[model samples]
Target: MEEGLENFVPLIKRSRGYEELEKDVIDSGICSGCGACAAFCDRVGLTEDGSVPASECNMTLGAVKCNIDGICYDCCPHVSYSWGGLEDEVFGARREDELLGQYLKAFAVRSKDKEVLKNAQDGGAATSLLLAAVNEGFSDAAVVTGRDDSWSVDSTASKDKKEITGGAGTKYARAPGILKLGENLRKIPRLAIVGTGCQIAGTRRLEKKFLSSVPKAELTLIGLFCYENFPYTRLKEIIEDRLGLKMEDVTKTDITKGKLHVWTKDGKKHEKAVKEFADLAPESCVICRDFTATFSDITCGSIGSDEGWTTVIVRSQRGMDLLNAAKEKGYIEISDKVDLEAVKKTGGFKGKKRAKVLSEREKEGKFVPDYS
Candidate 1:
């Protein structure tokens, strides 16, 4: 037996393995691909697509059987759980603002660092905040999403300013960022994470489950506004085949004002309606309602801000403190001129869309998470 195998044997027997997760979540097509299930288990890992299982359940390979209360299933954001319960646990009350969820303040912010602004998407607020957190000793590292030359997204744990800056720009494709969290959680005591709604939700679930083992303050969540995410291959196909743009020549991509804009290295821009690629989005996104990353300490997006700024929604007191500290250190500039109604309109649309999707799934006898 391995050094720690005996201790995990008892827990493994009491926990549901990947088989149940496959049937209930993956097979049902509601898995968010957050990688929470595979993050904590050696037997479970994601396939090359960054979603779905890599192999069968190792625990059930022979005569071993898995039981209920598995960590994999329990930590999944797609599994049935009380959204209100999580809200209350995180914010001390259920959200009154159904659209934006719980928030203490909102701002139109931009980064003061020239390099960060140059490399980041929107105003570089997320990158600046992460830099401040690591520089000030609030966090030892940050797990962020970055892309390669071909726009393939992946997650990395950045421990320094240069590493964090490298992960500045956004990639429209989904990457399972929680895998990095699980890998570095034990080694890095203080960590920050930047992710979309589903990824943040999974992190919150992990935090709640391992609260005794890991303190709540150990992890900081900075959420990004995500309406939906596309598989990298499909998105690449759309760019290469449909838009007639080579992935190698594409410099940047942005979604704003209902349009998907792709910029090439030669300064040529290609544009298409955002809705044109709706069919390419993941099936799991249909059931997701977290447009503003409601569970995060701070949420950043381009929805309610100007062309060169990011809309910042501060949710927790810790988030506020961090933002203030960053501002004091001259990492970013904040303005109280956000278009709240604009943010609300986008979030409300997502919530309504999710409700309709869930209703349809319920009627079709498909598995749906307990939103109530």
Candidate 2:
């Protein structure tokens, strides 16, 4: 066992199962829909609305009669855990930056590959890094979110460059990308995952639980900056009903500068203020304080860079190594022209929003996840 994990084993052995998860997180309306709970347990699945309890859990059904140590509850990101402990374990130090978390370097980067740039939402830096990791033997496979023809997103494990490229471009909806980790943990020794803040947190929790038996450095986490994400059904409705653009007709969708932009096959751009769709955001997002995926090795976003570049925040030596390898191999170009203030401003905005929401919830005596 990994050092310090022996102390955790007894606590994990006493952990409650899916029944408690449903009562605490799912029923409380704070489920982030990252699907970590259901990923490892076959009896537990996500409902149609993306909540848990799709089927009766084995523990709940008394099939196994095991009331404790359920991996489902233990792996949940929304469940109460020590944020500072996670920070110390992942980064070896607490973050000094109040908003952007710990980081070694930041850059505005773009992919050198023409095809990646053509298909990418912003700078294709994410795609470039994943390709570099696979080609350089940094990882054997990458888990990423991909969209169907109608722009509905799903998680996929891509083992090759061609498969990884299929996951290029951003989808504005939440996907259970961390579920791919649970599915492939035993099969793929070296793995990487690209996901949003909540998904990355769940992946970290999974790593803390299961990766002790394996080499921890074999897993890489690449996170994306996300202020909020919408459900696919509501997003589709807004596109079709509010914008009058059919899902199939829409070629691309992007959120930038506080506006949601949609481009159709006919080359017409339709847009609306992001706040106009505020009602569609899930409650889970309102309580989330992580805007830049602070727990990840690296975080990428389009917030603080030029129109065609991605802002990359390197938070660990692994992240820096992979980024430098990509740059050295001519997979990507890095520029030091990123606007640091812009990035912090956006992160501060998200932090303040989460604070306001938490205060309101506290006043109402609502359940708040123990992020501290």
Candidate 3:
């Protein structure tokens, strides 16, 4: 029993999802107490304090407490991404070249609620896809987005098998949990993961590796058109300073709203014009070019549809099957040929191409990474 396991017990208990626990443990100091504990857990826990003692121990700490195994960290609710082990071993295989093709896919799932429609950045495609997959038995669980205990407001994987599944709406932040997909691969055999282009790409890299050893049923990918990601620290400051809402006061964030819709603890709603805060997006996003997930099973965006309807690009067989099942079951409303030209007219894919070209050059040693 490491001294830090006690501290990690609280963190593990506090984490709401596997993704939340994985990404946060290292930074939260949960892994600092028992380094071997997390390593024993297979890097699922990043620090020494990340592991808790197992129950049945006769020794008393202070208050009532249960000792957890290092493996328990594997089941921790706080992980964010699946970056360790197999993922790190195959990092060299991930490249723009691998992102060139389309996998199974679907699109254009709109919510019946006008509020849900207006509240979503697209046509509520993300939420619809998860519900549809679960309903159709295509997946055992849907890992969606939600806020962290710290109010970081990142997406967390939802584990509910029924109607009460958790996860807030689409957050503007580029979610950090996408990396946790590989870790949850064992628990939730079939998963429907939602994210933007980069996240989809990163997950696909993981999916490819994981599938090589396991079955493809372990992971499914859904992509949203991402123009940018919000800076966390600055975004928090602005939310508190500009909106006059304390960080903890923020209950949830919505991307579908024409403006940024923020709900506070007091039930007061604050709306920030999306354009006004556009500059707050992360700088790394500017260098990213994948406006649409080139290799994702499905690609979604507002480019080709009305404000309330999502435009889904079904590029693969799996995507078509998922969408077909969703439509047949009446979970989603799909209308085709709504804005084929207009969707194509909304440009920015060039950024993806440019980013890919730069990455290629960097890998080839023609360009060096700029630490600054």
The top-ranked prediction according to TM-score is 2
TM-score of each: 0.91, 0.92, 0.60
* TM-score for candidate 1: 0.91
lDDT of 1 by residue, 45-115 (tens): 77645556735455433234433235677678888788889988888868878668899999999999999
lDDT of 3 by residue, 1-372 (tens): 222222222222221322333334433322212122222233233211123333233213322233332222333212233423322333322322222333233334585545444445567766667777876878777777666644554444565633213353555543545545545554555788777765565455434422444534355677776655564565675577667778777766654433667888799888887667655644335444456665466777766777667878776667788888877886678876455455434344445545665566457554222211
Q: Which residue pairs clash in candidate 2? A: none
Candidate number with the higher TM-score (1 or 3) = 1
Runs of candidate 3 with Cα error greater than 4 angstroms are: 1-107, 112-122, 148-151, 159-165, 242-244, 247-280, 340-372
Per-prediction backbone clash count:
0, 0, 41
lDDT of 2: 0.80
Q: Any residue pairs clashing in model 1, and if so which?
A: none
In the range 77-111, model 2's lDDT, one tens digit per residue, is 88888878888888898888756888899999999
Residue 230 of model 3 has an lDDT of: 61
